[model samples]
Target: MDRITLKEQLEKYRTPYEEESAFIQDFIQLTEDPLAFNRERLAGHFTASSWIVNPDRTHTLLTLHKKLGRWLQLGGHADGNENLMEVALKEAEEESGLKNLRLVENSIFDLDKHIIPERPHVPEHFHYDVRFMIEADLTDKLVISNESVSLAWFTFDSVVDMIGYNPSILRMLEKTSKSEILL
Candidate 1:
């Protein structure tokens, strides 16, 4: 999406939250200089995702991203919806195929900033992400869709050890451990 298209979408989803506001303000500044925004950063990619903690809290589920080919939390494009919490919940359900999982309506995980790496087919842009923690029953029959190469549960310590994971994932780990975003 172009800067103008994304800006309009983001404006619709704008909430009272400071993080969301900060994202818009920064984006407006960035978009004013198209070449700088595209050359120096990512543009028009605002996403939300969920770090779903299983019932036992012994493990968290992750999707092995098909394109990125790394184990990561569930998330995707907002598609113009500004209710980031809803976007996260929708992604969790679509990616995991676990019907019992649900995002707590009133609570959300904190926002984290990351840059999209330059891809062969796409220019790099900044990712302004709003994350959340959703909960699910830990049954052995969890199914994953094609968006991921695989899905698995990992211990907290194991998650911390992942070498190439983005810092935002680590932040979610710390927050999830503290029960700041989960019930």
Candidate 2:
């Protein structure tokens, strides 16, 4: 979709947490810029992510990010794609080497704007991330990709401890409760 059309039609969802709600507003504002959907916009750009869980929702898959050296959900730059849902699915499939993914809900599951540390030729910038919930089999084989140092699955409680109790990641864990997952 074209930038202007997308800017005028971005979907807004309810997030109880103040931080997430604020991020949604900022995400909407980001769309005002013509380059917001493209990775080439160095200032910042949209990224889509998937909070991948097992089919039974008993575990979550995380990748040890190569650059940040932290376990993170699967995702990548939108690359000018205005359909974030599709982008999230594509990133999940590429990063985890998992197939036959299913969306738990076809809506925004979480919103995050994190700083991307500076690299050789890329300066630090915010990633206005839109996340979605995805499901796959726990028994499926996973192939690590170039973007990660490692990849693995863990229970929700295990993830809570593994990430060193990070607030945002904690928020996602809290949001993905059993009741919500069952829906």
Candidate 3:
């Protein structure tokens, strides 16, 4: 995942949202250093996350983020790994405690850039997050990690209502709803 390759991928990514499109353009322009995944790089860092669904696709997994206290999909810092797909998978498995997870596609499923407020020792910075869809059995045992206060599965409709109508989550639900990817 060199800068050139990532730039190409971002260019090819199609999204109906103007904000996301703008984000892609900005990410391409701002990310020049190969250490784009390191938080110390400061410009911003790449993150990988998963929109995980059960086998039936009727419910999705979300973690109550320990720091933010918001329900979000499982994911974490890239830790310098350029292969974001692998990062998404590893984070999903580690955070969800589900062993049989599989990627819905190798291509990017969603893109977002959000500001992370300053923490104890960490300064305020943006997270250039790349998200992917993953599938897992609902019956699989789920173990919550220290990073999360709790984990749960929620229906797409319910999630939208519960999470207070996030456009990104709705966009993912809309995309997956019509595709065979969820099946």
Q: List, residue by residue over 1-183, the lDDT tens digit for candidate 3.
A: 545666778889988878788788777765576778787867589888999997677899999999998889899898988878889999999998999998877688899898889888888888998899999998899999999999999997798777776677777777778675635
lDDT of each: 0.68, 0.84, 0.85
Q: Which residues of candidate 3, in runs, are more than 4 Å off?
A: 1-4, 180-183
- Model number with the top TM-score: 3
Q: Candidate 1 or 3, higher TM-score?
A: 3
Q: Tell me the tens digit of each residue's lDDT in model 2 across 110-176.
A: 8889899899999999999888899999888999999999999989868867878667777888888
Q: Which candidate leads the pack in lDDT?
A: 3
RMSD of each: 6.4, 2.2, 2.0
Per-residue alpha-carbon lDDT of model 1 for 9-118, expressed as tens digits?
54554444454455556644543553532223346455778888876666788888998888889888776555567778888888988788766444445565566777
Per-prediction TM-score, please? 0.71, 0.91, 0.92
Better of 1 and 2 by TM-score: 2
Q: Residue pairs in steric clash, candidate 2?
A: none
Write down the worst ten-residue block by lDDT for model 1.
Answer: 33-42
By TM-score, highest first, what's the ranking?
Answer: 3, 2, 1
